[model samples]
Target: MPPDYPYGDKVSEPISAYAKRIGIKHETVRTQCDKGILPIIQRKKGTKREVNLYALYLRAKYKAEQFIRDFES
Candidate 1:
């Protein structure tokens, strides 16, 4: 089962769907999940993978900070 996040009941979704939403390849998202770079929920003994939107938000924020740093340097 997926976790019950406090983000208004919208917890997570399959990596494929999230990839589509973010305009990225599914395999790229899957790789990120496998590498533990992105936050995920494993359902049924890791048979199912779900990505957390909040985690993605954090990632985006971090990326934005990096971009700004590169811009400054």
Candidate 2:
């Protein structure tokens, strides 16, 4: 985990919280989720949505690596 990761030890977090933690607008996160760009799961009985932090972290890592490889080439 990054030194500044908020919600310590949390595997999944609400979309709004995750957006705030990452310094982005919650609406943007919602939009991404609606578009299927970000992985998310809707709560079984509510309108609340949560994002899988581990999946997000892995996705970010993969994107970073891809960028690095492209830059190196």
Candidate 3:
């Protein structure tokens, strides 16, 4: 049954997925992290290792609101 998933704490997703979840494009996330705007460690596969979830959440929330306001009028 698909390993009986969603049964516990979820494993961290890939950088692209994380970025998408946070309202940032995959490339934008890569670039920002590369430029050190957000602290990110590299994994063995040459990908971002960790990112601040709260900061991502804040950015996503703010951008979502802004997008809504821009269209609401």
Those runs of model 2 whose alpha carbons end farther than 4 Å from true positions after fitting are 1-7, 43-47
Candidate 2 TM-score, true structure as reference: 0.64
Greater lDDT among 1 and 3 belongs to 1
lDDT against the true structure, each candidate: 0.82, 0.84, 0.63
Backbone clashes per model, in order? 0, 0, 0
Q: Write the per-residue lDDT of candidate 2 for residues 6-73, one digit (tens) a residue.
A: 44788788888889988999999999988989898776856788988777777887898999999999
Cα lDDT of model 1 by residue, 28-59, tens digit: 99999889988998867848899987776667
lDDT of 3: 0.63
Rank the models by lDDT, top first: 2, 1, 3
lDDT of 3 at 70: 96
Task: Indicate whether candidate 1 or candidate 3 has the larger TM-score.
Answer: 1
How does model 1 fare in lDDT? Answer: 0.82
lDDT of 3 by residue, 2-58 (tens): 343331343345568768777978888777777888655456675546655545555
The Cα RMSD in angstroms, rounded to one decimal, for candidate 2 relative to the true structure is 3.4
Error of 1 at 14 (Å): 0.9
Q: What are the clashing pairs of model 2? A: none
